[model samples]
Target: MSDMSEAPKLDDALGSLPGSRNFRLLADIPVRMSVEVGSTSLKLAEVMDLAEGSIVELDRQSDELLDIMVNGTLIAKGEVVTVNNRYGIRIVEVATAEARMAGVERRG
Candidate 1:
């Protein structure tokens, strides 16, 4: 870790950790983040037959934690919550860095 006593370099002062300079370069880049409740594959005909009020059963149980993904990689798991009348997620578990990297590799 970089010594906290020393002043940070002006060009990369935004990063507070060691190697943060490299991370700073990518800070402005945008990646899609999403929350997944559950997923299930259906036949083409079944999908086509869906109409208003149709119900689709997902693979996950109602009480199961949801997946929080960043750039298609699983980063955490959370449960849904209502915040000020809006939907939100309360993070329950965070994925290890190695696990996140493995997810990226699997996607790649």
Candidate 2:
């Protein structure tokens, strides 16, 4: 096997770039962004039993941070906020570039 330790880091690869033009080129590209409040899994029987007024419990606590995703990959965590009766997210933490890349790789 090759020495994996010899592989260049993600930061190193990015830092080696000569200019920001390559990065700027992608600035106009659009990506899907979403926020996940929580999730729960149910058996087929339970799923079928869901009704209009049914309440399903999620794994995450109400006070917990929500997952912020881009193109289905988690890139940050945030909390819900309300402004003028409109709902929004208040970003509390962001994942490192390496973490974001790792998420993309996992999904790929």
Candidate number with greatest lDDT: 1
Error of 2 at 21 (Å): 0.6
lDDT of 2 by residue, 1-108 (tens): 144599886556656687756765675789999999889889999999999999999999888899999999889999988877999878799989999999989987
Local accuracy of candidate 1 as per-residue lDDT tens digits, 30-64: 99989999999999999999999999999999989
Q: Once superposed on the true structure, which residue ranges of model 2 sit more than 4 Å away at CA? A: 1-18
Give Cα-based local distance difference scores for all models.
0.89, 0.86
Worst 10 residues of 2 by lDDT: 1-10
Clashing pairs in 1: none
Give the per-residue Cα lDDT of candidate 2 at 14: 56
Clashing pairs in 2: none
Query: At residue 50, what lDDT does model 2 achieve?
Result: 92
> TM-scores of all models?
0.82, 0.77
- Give the worst 10-residue stretch by lDDT in candidate 1: 1-10
